[model samples]
Target: MMHPSESCNHRKSLFNTMNRFIGAVNNMDQTVMVPSLLRDVPLDDVGDVKTVTDDTASNGSACFQQDADMYSSYVLLKSIRSVMEWGVLQGDGRGKERVGESEDDDLEKQFHFHLNGLHAVLSKLTRKANTLTNRYKEEIGCGNL
Candidate 1:
């Protein structure tokens, strides 16, 4: 049977970016059977995803309701994937940004650029999902799953 990644010849199927993202999100959902287990657990790289650091506080509190907890991280990752799925359904927001998108621009070039961006972001999200799953296991004191 053919894999779903080959459904669309994405960049000549050199990078199955969408399939990877969907797989990552699905795996995360399956591994994280109990969402409550991830509550209050701090992420490893808090600095990389501090969305909006509090400027009013002297102690420099972080965003996502003060701390970047595992539960929040899970929610954020899922939300992003959801948004991307929705974007696919509604078509890409190319004209909405309007940075340098002229009619003369090479469509293939733009497709490759966005495909590369998706690959990078999806790879990071996949890593974070796997890390969070491992952390959850550790939190529960289980060595192997």
Candidate 2:
């Protein structure tokens, strides 16, 4: 019962929605997504999640998490390097003198690194979710809703 123009528009909209979804999925980051994605399941079950989600790669947070992790890792590395370099500049020590450097330094570094990574990963996931949700909204059509 729909007009030809209306039908064509509907098809175009559907195609756009699908293309956008695939693009979003293909562009996700994986490294950062692994941990949190594993959170809800048993350690042994992680493999299952991976297997199940593998086909629908965009259905989970892997890609976004990875991108986030990379960005966070880069930032954390930069920050640590900066703090170390700056501390050296400010102090009268030589050969990468320890500032905030201790037995727990490595642990602290990792903790902050992961935390920052998590934050970034979550942010990216959120953005992707928002985008996909918007696409769904658009596909459903405002007038229909």
lDDT of each: 0.66, 0.39
Pick the TM-score winner: 1
Tens digits of per-residue lDDT for model 2, 1-145: 9999998667545344444433444333322233233232222212221122332234332322222323332223233334433553433233554666675658887877866665454344334433433433343354233
Tens-place lDDT per residue, model 1, 31-94, is 7878998887888766565354433123332224446799987786686677567753333333
Per-residue error for 123 in candidate 1, Å, reads 0.8
Q: Which runs in model 1 stand beyond 4 Å of their true positions?
A: 1-15, 50-67, 86-101
Error of 2 at 60 (Å): 12
The residue pairs found clashing in candidate 1 are none
